[model samples]
Target chain A: MHAYANPARFLRIARWLMPALLAGGIVFAGGALAWGLFYAPAERLQGETVRIIYLHVPSAWLGMLGWGGIAAASFAEIVWRHPLAGVAARAIAVPGAVFTAICLATGSLWGRPAWGTWWVWDGRLTSMLVLLLLYAGYIALAAAAAASGANRRVAAVFGLVGAVNIPIIHYSVIWWNTLHQPPSLSLSGSSMAPGFMWPLLGSTLGFTLLFGAVVLMRMRMLLAGAQADSRLRRKALSAGEAA
Target chain B: MLKPKHQRMVLLAAALTALLAAVLIAAWALRHQASYFYVPSEIKAHPPEADRSVRLGGMVRRGSVHNEADGVTVDFIVSDGRADVPVRFAGIRPALFVEGSGVVAEGHMVQGRFEADNLLAKHDEKYVPREMAGMTAEQARQTVAQTK
Candidate 1:
């Protein structure tokens, strides 16, 4: 795992794997969306609104999962001082924010008619909103750190501190009164019937693959950017000596 | 072997340890402070105290809403298929407030009814009029005021 910390080696792997991931993701996610919208049974209760589940669930899952990536990278950066850890965190942030936005938007659409409300400041929804803010904070802090070359420590610390919200978001439904429904899927078992479960699982897999591809893509860019920056710094130093 | 500089490593370890401790303690303390919204089914599964203030959200039972003589005080039932909670509220009903839509009421279960001091009506993502979708900020305020 750590061997991939070398930017060149990681790029070698990502170059080949990205196309495959994107292809597979498109097939699965596109297939699931079509199936969910056209083929899946209208829920006895929610009716057509149930289709939004295909998009909302995957995006919601990835949003939190993105943070998990950042937290893990932050841990590696702090403990092992892995050179690529910051790059990985930076790579994951924006895509995660995008997914979080999708989740909120799709959820609101589904909520209208189904929940009869588009927005609520309930625990689950509020915490998810907070996650969006946290993502923005991280992206800004990381960019500033990369620019200054000093105080990058604050960005890593922010990554870990923001992780506290992940658990809060997960447990919010169980802890506070919120308009959002309780989780349908859990490790124990899914509350959804088998019919609804298959496409949801498929879409989640597809979205996860897409997310992985995006992260790798961003990592490559960040790695190249850093390399260029360092090269410029070395050149400037030598030029000063010559002068 | 991959090793961070010793001084930075020690600082990181200390910071992480403190953060872990703080997160754990905060989570533990927040357990009580955070109250999960209960659907009628869960409420039936484990009934909370009648006097304890709590929040309940679910689809309002169709045709169950009844406006009292005063028009402000209304009674309704919130249901999650498996269970139902009778709720009473003394205030103007929100424009979106309707039977069979999702609602959240907060207060206490008093005398067999969930007496809510605050009632929030939830709307779905669809626009009925369609034209209203393109409304500007000023138009939105005017529309709201007109409704009031």
Candidate 2:
């Protein structure tokens, strides 16, 4: 991992990994969706509408996972000052926000049939909403920092501080008597049957890989931009010396 | 030259505006699709349009539940004293849904049947020291009320 910390080495490997990740993501996502949308039996209680769970649950999981990624990247940037960490953290922001929004929207869709209301201010929902806000805040801060050449360390500190909410969001359902259901899948046990579990697991893996691929691509772009800036600065300095 | 600080603020404002617009559009599109709550009596008096999806809420009438061979779908009746509406639901019933308790059913009215795609049972109103066994509506309401 330390060896790959160097941006040049990371880019070399990332270039090779990109196509494979993208292909795997498409295949797994497509297969899981097909199975979930068509092959799986309609829930006896929810009928066809229960299909929304395929999209909704995965998106929610990814939203949480994305934040975890941001937290990890932030830690690297702050503690190790790994040059690529800030770029990776910024890259994840938009996708994290998008996934969070998808989770909310699809959850609302599922809620109409299951809960009678499209929106609820329950503990689980509220915490998840806050998680979304954190993503937005991180993105806004990074953009702001970019303009003034604000220290990446400052952004990293904010990232670490914001990460405190991740655990709260995860355990909100357990700690509170709320309408939202508790975790269906956990290391201890899963309420879902094996048949349902397979597709869910497949979808989660696919989504994670997709997130990794996107983040790496965005990091590459950032690295390229930095290189260009350095070259232009060097050229201007040389011209001044010549003058 | 535009100050970098001002440039950042402008970009932030623009991004926020765009996000707000997208959210508003989605909310508007889904407004009509939003589900409404209805008691059994309301459903019987003024049934929803054939294709309109709505929720029915009330006590599950005693002796009105019959489980099918599949053990998943159950035919039951929801009642509000004045009226009882027959409902069909397929899936694992909520732990709370039981005879003589509040339930909410979501689906459409098709061919004189309130075909429920989902069913959720409301817990009792009393504060029972221990969780009670079986789906008992009266007990649930009693427990909930007691707790309150």
Candidate 3:
């Protein structure tokens, strides 16, 4: 991890890796979506509405994974002061929020048919909404810190503090009697049939790859911006000396 | 005194522990509020005040669903394997609303019958292909009965 703290080295690796991930993501996500949408049979209860699970589950997973990444990056930023840690955390915020929003939207769509409502204030739904809000707050706080030249640690600390909500979101169904169903997949096994589970897994992997590609793309852009800012500062310093 | 690096780690650890503790305490306090609905067993064990509106959630009792003469009102019993609450709702039910499934109704008790103003269906976690779920109605009823 420390070895890649050097920006140039990180950029060199990411250049090739980004496109590779993007291509793999497209292939897998496309194939999985095709399979899920057309090939997989309708669920016993939910019928065609269950097809939404292919998109919904992956977005929900990635949304949570994004925050988890931010929290880990925040930890590194605070403790080790890894130079790229802040960049990684900042890069994750927007995509994470996007995925969270997607999760909520797809969930609302699924609920309208299967659960008979577009939205409910159940434990699962509410906690996920809170996660989205946390993502928004993190993005805004990070931006404000950047603009004001304030300590980035403030945003980093917020990232770490907000991580407590992750567990709450995970356990909300078990902890409370909710309108939302409990997890279909767990460490023990899946409640879903092979016809559904395989494509769902494929879709999850595809989306995860896509998420990684997007985050890397954002990190590279942020790093380039930082480099430009520093170069401008240096040029100004030299011109002032000459004057 | 610890080195700055160690100091930061210790501080982060302490801060995280404190945050987790605070959240745990808050969740413990808000457990009842956090739960979206109460089961029939809970209602039977400790009924709420007459005027307070609360959500009641449980399985729709098999063979208990009845359509009233008014055509809008429907009567059913919600069961949680331990207790049962008879509910009456006068509204359009959802597409998934059926006997032997799960439902959540929001209203208050009036003369031992729950008068529900809103209803939302709940679903189970199982997701088998429709072809594989060609169980006879008797089999479906038995499954619900056994689960209940």
Which one is best on DockQ?
3
- My TM-score estimates for the predictions, one after another, are 0.74, 0.65, 0.94
lDDT of 2 at B86: 91
lDDT of 3 by residue, A1-243 (tens): 799999989999999999999999999999999999999889887889999999999999999999999999999999999999999999999999999999999999999988778999899999999999999999999999987889999999999999999989998888889999899999899876778888999999999999999999999999888889989999999999999
Steric clash pairs (candidate 3): none
Q: Over the stretch B1-148, how does candidate 3's per-residue lDDT look in tens digits?
A: 8999899999889989999999988987888889999999998888888899999999999999999999999999999999999999999998778888899999998878889999999988878678768776567546645744
Clashes of each: 15, 22, 0
Candidate 1 local lDDT, A1-243, one digit each (tens): 579778888889999998889888999999988888888767544556678889999999999999999988997887777889999999999999999999999988876666555786677888999999999999999999988787777888899889888987887766655666568788888655555778889999999989988988888888888889899999999999999
Cα displacement (angstroms), candidate 2, residue A82, comes to 1.4
Give the alpha carbon lDDT tens digit for every residue of B1-148 in model 1: 5344666667767876787688767767875455446677766777779768777878889999998998689989999888888999998666557777778777887766788987766543222222333566468557656754
Worst 10 residues of 2 chain A by lDDT: A41-50
Question: Candidate 3: lDDT of B141?
Answer: 49
Could you tell me the TM-score of candidate 2? Answer: 0.65
Per-residue lDDT of A208 in model 2: 71
Error of 2 at B29 (Å): 40
